[model samples]
Target: MITVTLDALDLSALLCSRVCHDVISPVGAIVNGLEVLEDENDAGMRDFAIDLIRKSARQASARLQFARIAFGAAGSVGATIDLADAEGVARGLFGDEKTKLTWSAPRALFPKNKVKLLLNLVIIAVTAIPRGGVIDVAVTGEAEAPVFVLTCKGSHARIPAHVEALMAGTPESGTVDAHGVQPYYAGLVARAAGMQVGFAIDGDTVTIRAEPAAV
Candidate 1:
């Protein structure tokens, strides 16, 4: 097993890199749209720029919302966040991409650490479906001790190897950059919460489960 030690600064840098990567496209689009609106004299072209600006702004907002909860202290401030809110954030995170979601969580709230883990797993599912697919996220057991199960299956589904290495804490590279940050953080959160996280990948499917701490 490979041990990786990451200080607070290292984690912050990698996480910021991840967020910046996700945010760049939409923000760039917004900038381009503004430039087009300023330079284009045609009314139709200006209207097109306006539409692009709106769409990109919304996407940026969604990504920020998703990241704030998934990778930041957004949930920590409140101790727990509502399931419905999490679902909404999940929906926004995927946008109208080829990936779809079927949420089966109970209509209850989730603790901050668990919520963060759940969102990280959701990101894992989203990345698996490069060619598009469905991610079914379900939670069982009581709110006081919830178990989360997420299955993501589709054509060409794959969980990035760096993420797998981080989960196992056996990175051959001896270092984790942006690719492994999410999973590493998720694992830390799970362990800190006295939870166990497991994953099984078979063919074009990946199943991720998180069980509550033993009594």
Candidate 2:
């Protein structure tokens, strides 16, 4: 059996779609807030509108910052980033979502590839639990081959079908859409880092790992 993959352009398209999908909600909330403030004469309601705008603005900014670092070429070549920064971004991305994050990494800088892989793995894990749950991320091993383990658990924790297909290098369809591109990108990034990826799933728990610590 053969799986469908995304080409460069298709991948680009899907990434764009995903970014837009995430950014739209917060931005739309800001607009709604503005409308509420304009139409509401009650002081309390106006205050509520203001709060909504503030929260939505912050969330929008957080998501954008996370996406910039996670999805874009925001860092210099061969640069290492602070793990705290990644954790903060992850927290911001899950704002108001039912998911919780537990990070078990060092405070030191991590190679850009490893940082990216960690974030992508977070995305995959977060998306796996639609009913909300906990995400535990850890990093260890030699710097040359840092190993990462991501565990996702919740009431309905499970890997996405698209991710499974991409991981196996054989998607069920010919084109990789936005909803299925993160896993594909994660695998690609893992390989580029001179690492291998593996996963295990048991009932409500799913684990993903990257080996040979990326440089």
Candidate 3:
């Protein structure tokens, strides 16, 4: 008899895909805003529109840069990155938005791949709370292993069920939206990287933890 076991490694990839899925909307919004701002008329309206474009663009860029490390792909081996750079990516994403962010991580604990996945999920969680909320992110890993813990809380928890299901690796075709797409892509990436993804809901909040698997 053979039994299959899905570990944290699998979860990481799944969550990475989920991260990609969720980011498209806001990213697209940034693109649209840019197009509108190009020929924007009216000084007052243009200023207002510029501010909106800047904020959205910042958010999109932050999410994409972070996701590249988290969901899309990994960086070069032993590539040393500035501590402030990592935090800056997160700050750019978490700041100037309705969501509040709190982060804690040791120096160079995660590889580029892990960092990207973690940051991607951070943006996803923060966005889940549109009206304003709090997001907590922590990084932990070493030569033996590494992991990330992400928690997002808000007054109204409106995370779609399909998104949660995607995180769990059970996605449906009809409900496959941007949010679910990220998880689906993440699942693929995680499999390639040998990692796992885990997700749970707490009251009105959701938490996801991802880690690499042992060979």
Highest lDDT scorer? 1
The whole-model C-alpha lDDT of candidate 2 against the native structure comes to 0.82
Alpha-carbon shift of residue 93 in model 3 (angstroms): 1.8
Q: After superposition, how far is residue 18 of candidate 2 from its true place, in Å?
A: 1.1
Clashing pairs in 2: 3-171, 145-212, 145-213, 146-213
Which candidate order results from sorting by TM-score in descending order?
1, 2, 3
What TM-score does candidate 2 get on C-alpha atoms? 0.91
lDDT of each candidate versus the true structure: 0.85, 0.82, 0.63
Candidate 3, overall lDDT? Answer: 0.63
Looking at model 3, report the run of 10 residues with the lowest lDDT sum: 1-10
Task: Please give, for residues 120-169, the per-residue lDDT of candidate 1 as tens digits.
Answer: 88987777778889999999987667889999989988766677678656
Q: What TM-scores do the predictions have?
A: 0.92, 0.91, 0.64
Name the regions of candidate 3 deviating beyond 4 angstroms. Answer: 1-60, 71-74, 77-84, 127-130, 158-160, 174-179, 212-215
